[model samples]
Target chain A: MADHAAHALEPNPTARAFCLTSAFWFAVATTAGLWAAGYLIAPDFMANIAYLQFGRLRPIHVNLVLFGFVTPGLLAAAFYYVPRLTRTELFSQRLGVLTAWLWNLTVTVGIVSLSLGFSQGREYAELVWPVDMLVVLVFALVGVNLIMTVHRRREPVLYVSIWYVFAAVVLTALTYALGNVIWRPDTGALLGIPDAILLWFYGHNIFGLLLTPLSLGVAYYVIPIVTRNPLYSHTLSLLGFWSLLVVYTHIGTHHLLQVPVPTWLKVVAIVDSIAMVIPVMAFLINIWYTARGKLGEIHADIAGKFIFTGTIWYFFVSIQGSVMALPQVQRITHFNNWTVGHAHIGVLGFAGMIALGGMYFILPKLSGKPLYSRFLADLQYWLVLIGITGFLVILTTVGLIQGNAWFNGETVYRVLPEIHLYYVLRLSAGLAILSGAYIGLYNMVRTLFFNPGVQA
Target chain B: MIQRMTPTAVILGAVAILSAVVFVVIIWPNTTVDMTPSEIFRERTAEEAAGRKLYIANGCVYCHSQSIRAFDWGHGATRIAQAGDYVQDEPILLGSARTGVDLSQEGGEHPDDWHMAHFINPRWTRPNSIMPPFEHLGMENLRLLTRYIQSLGMQAADKRMQRQAFWKQASTKAYEAGIEANVRWLSETVPQGWRDIPTPYAASDYSLARGRMIYQGFCIGCHGPVGDGMGDAQPHIYPPPLNFTILKGRGISGGLIYYQVMNGITGTAMPYFKKELESQKIWDVGNFIAAYFIDELDANGPPRGIDAAYEP
Candidate 1:
C-alpha cells in the first residue's frame, strides 16, 4: 500500500498518536449519534430510560459531534501539519496526549451528566457550569500547545493553516466564556432581553467562529497537499479569514431579528448577514482556484473527496444561513425546524464532513499502516453523505410546513400531523450517520492495534 | 496530457450563471404578496406611524405575521387578509416566527387597554407567552405600538375596536356598580344552559395533574402562577388577566370555560389556544384553573351521557 512508502518516508510518533486519538473519538461520537437517532425514531423505543430521552440525547448527539468527533479529528490533522509545515517536531507529544485524554473525559462527563438531566437548560450551552469550565480549560491548553509549537518553529513563514487553528482556539475560548455566561451561576442569564441577545450572539458564533474556522483550516491544509499545488491566492485566503471574523462577529443579532432588541441592532445583523456573501465567496474562490485543474486528484483521494464535498455544503449552508437571517425570510424559518435543519447541515454536513476527511487523511500515516478496511471507510463515508443530505431535505421541508401553517393562522395542533412524518424521517437519517460512526471506529481500532503488520 | 477546465474558469462560469438565474428567477419579480387597503388602514396617525417604525425596527415581524389566508380559519379565523391591504407598504411586515400569536387581523381583537398590558409583558395578559417585553419602548410608545397592532386588520380591526369600546364602557359601569352587578354582568353574557353544565372529566388527580402541566405550558405565562390573570403578560393586557377568583360561586360552567379557552376573548390578549394545544390539553388546563385557582370543580360524579358503544 502507498501508506508503507509514506511511512518509510517519515517516521513521526507524535503525528501517529494524534491520528489514533482523533480516530477513537470519531468512533465514539458516531455511536452516540446513532443512539440519538434511534431515540428520535421511537421515543418510546427506549422507554422507561432516563438517559435516552429525546431532549437529553439530542444534545449528546450535537455536543459529541462537535467536540468529540469533529474537533479532535481536525486538531489531529493540525498536530501533524503544524510540525510538518514548520519543519520541526511537535512541541510536546506529552501535552498533546494529555489534551486528547482530557477532551475525551470531558465528552464522557458531558454525555453522562446531560443524560442524567443535569443540564443548565441553555441550547448549545447545555453543559453545567463545571463542564463548561473544563471546555474552556481544554481550549486554553490547546492554544498553549499550538502557540508554543509555532513559537519554536524552524520555518519563518506562518502558513494560513496555522493562522486559522490559532484564531479558532483563541476566539472560541473568549466566545464560549461570554456565551455560557459563566459569571451567572444560578440562571446563566442577565435578566431579560439582554440575556436573550447575549445568548444567541454566543450561540451563532459557536458555529461561525469555532466550527467554521477550524473546518476551513483543515480544508486549506488537505486540499493543496492532495492536489500537489500551492494555494491560488494567499491574499484571497487571508481576505476570507479576516472577512469571516469581521462579518460573522456582529451577525449573531440575526438570530434575534424577531425579538424586541433595539431596531438598529437588527439592521446591523441583517446588513452583515447579507454581506456574509463576500467572505463566503472569497473562501470558495480561493480554495476552488487552488485546486484548479485537479479534479482527478480530488476524486482520487478519499480525504480530498470528503473535504471538497464539505466545501460545497458550506456554500449552501452559509447562503441558506444568510437568507434565513433576513427578517422576511426568517418569518418562515425561525422558531421552526428550518434553523434546526441549518444547525445540522452546518455542524454535521459542513464542519463534520471536513473533520472526517482530516481524520482519514492522517490515520494511515499515523498508524503506519493502510486502513484496516478501505471498503469500510468508504462505506461509512457514503452513509454519512446520504444521511446528511437526507437530513437537509427532510428538515427543510418540515420547517416550511410549520412556517406556512403558522403564517396562515392554522392553530399549532393542526400542523402536528403534517410534521410528525418528517421527524420520523430525521430519526432514520440519523441512523445512517450513526452506522458510519461505528464503521469508522472499527476501522480505526483495527488499524491502530490489530493490524497484522510490523512497524517499520 | 489531461484536458481540464481551470478551477478559476469553472467557478467564474458557475457564479455568472447563478447570478443571472437568481436575477431572473428570484429578484426581478415581486417578492412580497400584495395586501389591500381598507378605510381604517388608509392612513396611520403620526404616533401610529412612529409605532409602526418601532415594530419594524424591533424585528416584531419575525414573530408576528401580518397576513392571514382562507386556510387560517381553523384558528378562529378572522377575515383573511387581502393583497390590497398591503398596497401602502414598503417592505411589508409579514413576519415569520411564531413565538407569539399571529397578528394579521389584530385590529379590535382587544381593547387598547389589553394591548398595553400585553406589550409590556406578554405573560401578564395570557400567561405562557415567550414574547419578549417591549418595556424599553416605554409606556408612551408601548401605547402607540398597541394602536398600530390593533390596526393590523384595518376594517375588521375597527369593528373589533368598536366592540372593545362598547365593552369597556359596560365593564367600567359594572365594576363601579359593585361586585354583585359586575359578576352578574360577566355571567349574563353566557347563555343560561352553559352556566349550569358541570365539567365532564370529574377533576380526578390524574386529570388535574395533566391540567396543571397544560396550564404551565400554555397559560402560566399570562395567567399568573396563581391564576390571578397576573401572568407576565398581565401588564400588557387589559381589562387585565381575567381574575378567576371573581367567578367564585358565580355559577361558571365547564362549557363556558371550554368556550372561552377555545375561542379567546377578543379585544384582550387571551389568545385562542385551539391551534397550539389539543382538546384534551385545553380541558385539562380548564379543570386545573377550576380546581386549584378558583377552588371550583364541577368535573365530578358518574357518567351522565348514554354511551354510544354501550347498550342501555
Candidate 2:
C-alpha cells in the first residue's frame, strides 16, 4: 500500500472513448455557434433554411456545448481520475463505455430532433420528452457506475475532487429531471411562472453544480499536481464546497428580477447571488495559495496552463455575476448582449477552458503516450482565450449601447444599425473559437489513435 | 466534513441541497403563483395555438419580446406585462431580447396584409427593421404566424378586429359606389375640423420632394408609384387600395388627406402613420397628393398660419 499506487497505470478505455466523443462534438457545437453568430450579423445569411435558422441553431449550439463538448470533456477526465483517486478499478468499464455510446446517441438525437422542429421550448430544457428521458437515463448510468467504484474504494479518505465528481453527477441528474418536469411528460412544464422558476433553478445549476464543480474539481486535482505542491488546506476546501452548495442553488431568480416575480424571492436570489463571493473567494484563495509563485511550473504543463487560466476566469466570471445580479446592474445587463458576454466567459472562458485542460491532461495518461502535438493544444488555448475575451468586450459594448438606447425612447430599429458592426466583430471572433475547436479535435483524434510520440 | 464523507453520505448531502433549493425556488413559486388569467387573456384558438408553435419552432421569440416591463419605453411601455396574461400558455414565451420590436401588444397593430408583406420582407413596411424575413414559412405558415401575432393581446385583439371589420365594410362599399360617392364618404368620415382645416404650411418644392420620399418608403406597396391604387399589395388587400384619381375634383380637402393618412382608414389596406410619421411629414405628403393627383390648391391658399420652417 504505497502512496504511488494512487496513480492509475492501466489504460482507461471508457475515458478514451469519451475523449473522442468530446472532440467530435466540440467541432459540431462550434460550427453551430458560428452559424448563430453569422445569423446575427445578417439575419438573412442562412435565411429561409429551416434547420439552419438562428433560432434552431442557437439551441443546438447551447445544448451541444453543455452535453456535447464541455460535459464530455470534463467526464473524460473524471472517468480516468475517479478510479485512480478511489484506488479501485472502474466499477465496470463495459458499463462506462456503454454510457459513452448512449451519451453520444442522446446528443445526436437531440440535434436531429431540434433540427426537425421538436422542442419543449424551455431555455435549458429544450429537449423533447423522449430525448429528455434519454438524458436522464445516461446521467443515471454514469452516476451509478461512479458511485459503485466509490463503494469499493481502497482509499480511506475521499479526496475533494472525488467529492466534486459525485456532486456534479448526482446533482445534475436530479436537477435535469425536476427542471425538465419529466413527470408530466406531455408539455414538460408547470403552469406559467412556476415553470420559469423550475427551469432556471435547473438551468443555473446545470452550470453551477455540473460545470463549476467539475471544472473546479479538475483544477483542484491538476493544479497542485502540476505545481508539485500539496493542497493549501483541507479546511478551506471544505468551506468552499459547502458554501458553494448553499449559495449557488438559490440565485436562479436573479433572472426574473425585472419581471413581476415575488419580491421576497427576488431579494433572496439577489442576496444569495451577491453572497456568492464567500465560496468564490474561498475557492480562489485555496487554489491560488496552492499554486503561488509557481507560474513557470504551471505553464510548463499545457493542461496546467489551461486549468490555471480557468481559475482566473472563474474569478472574473464570479465577480461579474455577483455584480450583475444587483437589481440596478441587471437593469442594464439583463436580457442583453452583456449577459451574452458574461455567459461566453463563464461557459467558454471558465468551464470550457478547464474541460479542455482536463481532456488534454488525461489524454496522455489514457493513451499511454505523450501528447502528440503540444503546439496544437497550446495554439487552441490562445485561440479560445482571445476568441472568448473578444466576445466579452464586443458584446459588452453592444449591450451597453442597446440597453442605453432602450432606456431612452429609441426604437429597436434605431439601435440595429448601431450594433451591426459589433455583430460582425462577434462573428469574426467566433471563427477563432470555431477554428480552435476543429484544431483540438484533430489533436485529440491523433493523440487517441495516431500519436507518433513516445510512450509515457 | 466533505472529505470525511463516504460516497453514499456525500450523495445524500447533494440530494439534500438539491431538495432544499427545489422547495424554496420551485415548490414555493408553484403554490403561490396566481392561476387566474388576466382580464385581457383568453384561451387560444386552435389556429392561434398552431401559430404559437410555429412562432416557437421558428425562433421568432429569440428576437421579439412578449413581456413589456415598467421602464421599457417606446411601444414596450404601451402595456405593463402582467403575469396572469400567460396562465393559459403552456410555455410562456416572455422572451429576453428586443432585436426587433416588442410584440406583447402587437396584435392588430397592422392589418393582415401588412404583416404578410412584412413577413415576406420586413423592409416592405419598415425600411430599417433588422427582422429576418419569414418568407420561407410559406403562405400557410405565415397566415398561422399572423393569427398568433394578432392574438397576442387576446381579448383586446378581438375588440380591435371588431372595429376593423366594422369599418372595412363601409370603406369597401364606398369604394364600389363610384368615385363621387367615395370621395364624399372619405371626406365625411374625417372629423369636421380636419376636413375644413387647410394645411398651415405652404407647399414648396422641398415639401413635395420630402413627401415623395416618405410615400415611397411607406405607402408605395399599396398606393402604387402613380397613386392609381394598383400597388403590389392590391391582390392581398380587400376593397383594393383607394384610387387617388377618384378624389380629384370631388372636393378632396388637404385636411381630409392629412386625417386619413394620420389615423388610417381601419379595415382597408391603409395603415396609420401616426406612430411612424411626424405632423409635418403627414401634411407634406397630403399636400403632395393634393397637388399631383387632385389638382387641388388648399395649401397654396389661405386658412393657413405661419409656415413651418424646413428643419422644424
Candidate 3:
C-alpha cells in the first residue's frame, strides 16, 4: 500500500478536468431523472411545457446519464491509472484535457438539441447527427492519447486494466458509428424492422462494450491496490475479457425477443444471454477472491466500499438480466417498469456505483490532498444505496401488478390508477438519489479545488 | 499465452469479433429480412407524413407503442404486428414502454375532435391518464399530429374512419334536429331485444359506490360529475356529451344504457369501454346513471331475472 501511494507529485490536469465533468453531470442527470419521475406521479403538475414534457425529458435524462455522468467518471480514474500501470507519464495532457472539453461540449449540445425536440428517435442513440459526430470525434481523441501513452510505456507486459480501457474506447467508437448509421446523416437510421434490430444491437452494447468494461477496469485496478493483494488469477481475467466480448456482442437481440425479428436470431440471443454467466462469474470470482478476508480493509476505504458494493450489484443485475431474457419470464417483464428497475440496477447500481468509486479513488491522488470530507462521501454512499434498492423493490412490484393485469386482459388505462401509489413511492425514493448527486458534486468540487486539508 | 497479450492484439481482436457479430446480427439481417408491405399497409398522405415528423420530434413514441403483439389484450390487439407492416417506417416506432395504451390501431378509435381534446390535455378525456399534454404544440400542430395518429393502422384505420364519418353525420343530423329526436335516435339504434330488457341489479349502496369509483375514472372526464354532460372536454367535442337528465320520462332502459357505454357511440367523442370495463362494472355504472340522473328506477322491478348467487 505504501508503494502504491508513492506516486508522482506533479498535478494531473486531465484527470482533474474529467473528475469535475463527471461530478457536474451526475448532478444534472439525476435532477433530470427526478423531474421526469415527478411527471409520472402528476402529469399535469407543470403541464403544457413542450420541452419539459415526459417524452422529451426521458431521453435527456437517459443520454446525460450514459454519456455525461457515468462514462466521464470511469474515464477520470482511467486517466490516472493507465499511465501508472504502463510506468510512464501520459503522452499528452494537453490532448487529454482538450478531449475532456470536447466531451462537455458534446454533452451540452446533446441536451439542448434533445430538449428542443431534435432527437434521432432511437434509445441510447438519440443524439442528432452533428452531436453524434462530436461523440465519435471525442472518443477518437481519447483513444489516440491512451494508445500513444501505451506506445511510450517502459513496461513490456500490459496489465489487465490497460486491456479493458483500450477496448472500451475503441470498441465504443466503432459501435456508435454503426448504430447511429453515421453514413446516413439525414435520418441516422435504417428503414423498418431492420432499424429496430440495429438500434437495440447498439443500445445493449452501450453497456456491454462501454460501461461494463470501463467499470471493470476501475475495479480491477482499485480492488487489488486497496486490498494489498495481487490479482487472484490472470487466467480468469483472460477468460472474462474474451468471453464478455464474444457473448455480449451478439445477445442484443434478446431485447427483440417478443418483436417480429426472426426466430433464429431470438434463439441465439436467448442462448447467449444465458451463456453470460461464464464471463460474469469469471470476473466476479477474480475480483472477490482478490479481496477475500480483507472486508475490513475494503470498508475502511470509502472507494473500496463503493466499488465492492458495485460488484454485488453486478452479480444481482446479471442474474436478473439472464432470467429476463427467457421467453417465459419476458412475457411478464418486457415493456414495463420491471425492465426499468433492471436498468436502474445495472446502470445506477452497477456501473454508476463503480464510476463514483473510481472518481473518489483518484481525487486525492491527483490533487495530492486527502478528500474534503470523508463523512459526506459515506453519506452519499448510503443515500445512493437506499435510493437504488428502493427503486428495485418499488418498481418491480409495480411492474408485476401491470404485467399481471395486462395479461389478465385489463386495459392499460384501467391499470393506471392502481399503479399511481407506486409512482409516488418511486418519486420519494428518487429524492434520495437526487440529494446524493448534489452532495457528491459538492464533495468532488471541494476536493478538487477548495480543500483546506493538508497535502499528503 | 493469453497473459502475453499485446495492445495491438487486444484492439485488433475486439474489432475483428465485433465485425463478425455485426455481419451476422445487423448487416446480414438488414439484407435478408423481407420488406414486403402487409395487407393493411398503405402509403401515408403528405399531411400524415408531416405529422409523423412532429410525432418523432415530440417523442410521443416513448409512451405509446406502435407495435401490437399476439398476446396483448389492450388497444390494437385486433391485429398482431408484422415486420411487413413497418416497411416504410424510417426508424420503427415500436416503443419499449407502455406508459399509455398501444396506438397501433388507434387511428379510428375516436373522431378527430377526441384526439384534439386529448392532445390538448389527455385528462380532459381520460382523467386517469398520466401522459403529458401536448397543448404547447399549438392547434395547427395538434391537427397534424391527429392526422398522423389517425393514419396509424393504414388501410384498416381508413375503414374505421369511414364508419366513423358515416355515423358522425347521422348523429350530428339527429342532434341538430332536436333533443327529442336525438334521444329517439339513440334508443332506436339499440337492438329491439336490448331496449326491452330492464335493469337487473338493484342500485344497492355498495353497487353505487363501486359505480361512483368507475365513473370518476372513466366517465367524469366527459360525462361530468353530476351526469350533466358539462365535463371539461365538452367545449371541444361536437354533438357534445349527452345530458343524462334528458333521458328521464323518455323511456330510457338499463339495457340501452349498458349497450351505449359498452360499445361507445362512434363518430362522436364517445369511446367504447368494452376493452376497459367488465360486465359487472358496466352494469353497476349503468344502474347508477339510471337511478341518479334519469330518476327512473326500473331496477329490481317486475319481470326481473333470477337473482345472482351473490346478491341478497
Top DockQ hit: 3
Flag clash pairs in model 3.
none
lDDT per residue, candidate 1, A1-456, as tens digits? 011135432444555555565566656666666665554344335443545644456567677777777777778788877787777777888887788778778888987887776665555676877898899998998888877887787776767777677777877787788778789765454433445455666677788778888889899888988888878887787678767777777677687665445566678778888999988999899899989999899887888988999999999999998888877787777767787788878887898889888877877777677667778878988998999999899989988998778777566545654666787898788778778877877887787779875555
Of the pair 1 and 2, which is ahead by lDDT? 2
List the TM values for chain B, per candidate.
0.77, 0.86, 0.97
RMSD to true structure for each model, in Å:
13.2, 3.5, 1.2
User: How much of the true contact map at the interface does candidate 3 reproduce, as a fraction?
Assistant: 0.75
Which lDDT value does model 2 have at B150? 88
Candidates 2 and 3 compared: the better one by lDDT is 3
* Model 3 lDDT per residue over B130-159, tens place: 989888999999999999999989999999
Q: What is the DockQ of candidate 2?
A: 0.52
Which stretches of candidate 1 lie above 4 Å from their native place?
A1-5, A9-42, A453-456, B1-312
Among the numbered candidates, top lDDT falls to 3
lDDT of model 3, residue A412:
84
The order by descending DockQ is: 3, 2, 1
lDDT of every predicted structure (CA atoms)? 0.70, 0.84, 0.91
Q: Report the Cα lDDT for residue A366, model 1.
A: 74
Instruction: State in Å the error of residue B34, model 2.
Output: 1.9
- Candidate 2: which docking quality band? medium
Per-model TM against the reference: 0.64, 0.91, 0.99
Best by TM-score: 3
